[model samples]
Target: MTIRFGLLAFPGVQQLDLTAPYEVFASMDDAEVHLVWKDTSPIVSATKLALQPTTTFAECPPLDVICVPGGVGVNTLLEDADVLSFVRKQAAQARFVTSVCTGSLVLGAAGLLKGKKATTHWNALDFLENFGAVATPGRVVRDGNLFTAGGVTAGIDFGLTIVAALRGREEAEAIQLSLEYAPEPPFHSGLPEKASVEVLGRTRQRLAGSRMARQAIIARLAAARHGAE
Candidate 1:
């Protein structure tokens, strides 16, 4: 079977969050990888890196897996009706719906994480409850068909886990070995709980505006959706 895996891309999307899993999917056996964006042209990342998408969100075929990536742009993308609607629709038909970093916030905005257990970049885990998800602290949390991973590099682990679920542990292990999966972080401050006071404060400040903006948009969207019904 040629598994169709769609990776959602938007302006200011995270680099590693999208690319790490893209590598994994590309290495998978007989899997078709697609980078989907709102526009048919190139999309820029938060780090100012530009990427050309293979398909538009509306044009993507029914996918075996859908991966939503997160970065600064998510502050606006979470509230984008077009993106959220597309995600909700595609996710309904996908065998697996996965997210990396704050991408879970987008999934939550799409109303796909309600009453599910999920995890995201540690700093944002508390916000997951707003979507009715049980916030998890682990690197990867698998609740049924919804898979969420922690910040940045966790996408690789998340992909391996999904591969194990889809194919088998042996297949996942083989892929892991092929990629030489090993971690050696220079800093111990990756997680909020483990970070120094200054590091945590700085990180929070950097994301504070974005988080506030997303929260406002979420409130507005919720009200609008509720009023329409």
Candidate 2:
């Protein structure tokens, strides 16, 4: 059986978030991985890497898995009706609904995260509560069919987790071995909890603009939702 995986590709997306999982899924035998977008036009990543969409929302076939990979682009997606609708429609039938980093926020925006335990980048963790989701802190968090991953590199681990769930432990392990997926960071400052106060502060400062923008968008969304109620 062919397992079809669709990963959302958008302008300003974090390339690694999409490509890391794409690598894992594409490596699987009989697995088809697609870079899906609104159109087939080329889009650039947050780091300025160019990516071409393999399929559009209208042309993409039914997928076994629909994954959203996040970055600065996700801020715009949170309020994009078309993107949210596509995700909602796909999530309804997809076997797995998944995300990386702030992509979980997009799922939340589409009303998929309410009361579900999910996780995102540590910087955006608290924002999940605004979407009525329990903000869990972890590299990978799974609640039933919804799977979410933490910042950036965590997508690799998330992909392996999903692979194990869909295929088998042995296959997942084989893929891991084939990719040599091992991590050895020279610094212990990956997480805010483990990082020195100065390092954490500097990192937060660098991310403050995007974080603040997301906060405003979430607040606006929450207010609109309450007004409708």
Candidate 3:
């Protein structure tokens, strides 16, 4: 049987976070990958790159996997009723629900991570607690059907891990070899604790404004959902 995969797209999505995983899944034998968006036309990335969606949320099939990727756009999606609703519904039916970076926040917004251990972009782990998730520090954490990965670049690792789970380690290793998945960062600032205090402060400052906005929206959504309950 052909495995069906869905990759969600929204405005402000990190280009690499979504594409890297796509390349992995697309390379798999007998897998059909669909870019599912809220729209039918095109979605623009945070970097202003344009991507066309093959399917809209309303038309997405019962998926074997649903991959949500993080980016600057997540701040806007925090309170988007339609997007959250689609995520909740599709994830409920999906065999595997996966997220990268702040994409976990969107899954949390969909009520998928409650009482579950999950991880997100290092800078955003505290926010996951706001949704009742136990913030983990691993590059990838798989809890039942929900698999989450940390930060932007971690998507590559997360995808490779899942590929091994689905197709076996040998197949995944062959693909990894073909892709030359080795990484050698010039600096040791990838993780939050590894970075210098000054560098962390500077990076936090750059994202502070957007983070605050997203936090506020997340709080409001949580409150609204609580009130309904």
Q: Each candidate's TM vs. the true structure?
A: 0.93, 0.99, 0.96
User: Which 10-residue window of candidate 3 scores lowest in summed lDDT?
Assistant: 217-226
Q: Could you tell me the TM-score of candidate 1? A: 0.93
Candidate 1 minimal-lDDT segment of 10 residues: 213-222
- Per-residue error for 128 in candidate 2, Å, reads 0.2
Using lDDT as the measure, name the better of candidate 2 and candidate 3.
2
- Model 1: clashing residue pairs? none
Error of 2 at 86 (Å): 0.3
Query: Which of 1 and 3 is ahead in TM-score?
Result: 3
- Compute the lDDT of residue 19 as modeled in candidate 2: 95
**Model 2 scores what on Cα lDDT?**
0.95
Once fitted onto the true fold, the runs of candidate 2 whose alpha carbons sit more than 4 angstroms away are none
Give the alpha-carbon lDDT of every model. 0.89, 0.95, 0.89
RMSD of 1: 1.6
Predicted model with the maximum TM-score: 2
Q: Per-residue CA lDDT of candidate 2, range 60-119, in tens?
A: 999899999999999999999999999999999999999999999999999999999999
**lDDT by residue for model 3 over 1-229, one digit each (tens)?**
7889898888899988899888888887788999998777888999999998899988999888999999999998878889889888888888899998899999988888999999998778889988889898899999999999998888888888888888899978887888898999999998778999999999999889878888789788878878999
Candidate 1 deviant stretches above 4 angstroms: 225-229
Number of residue pairs clashing in candidate 3, backbone atoms closer than 3 angstroms, sequence gap of 3 or more or interchain: 0
Ranking by lDDT: 2, 1, 3
Residue 28 alpha-carbon offset, candidate 1, angstroms: 0.9
**Better candidate by TM-score, 2 or 3:** 2
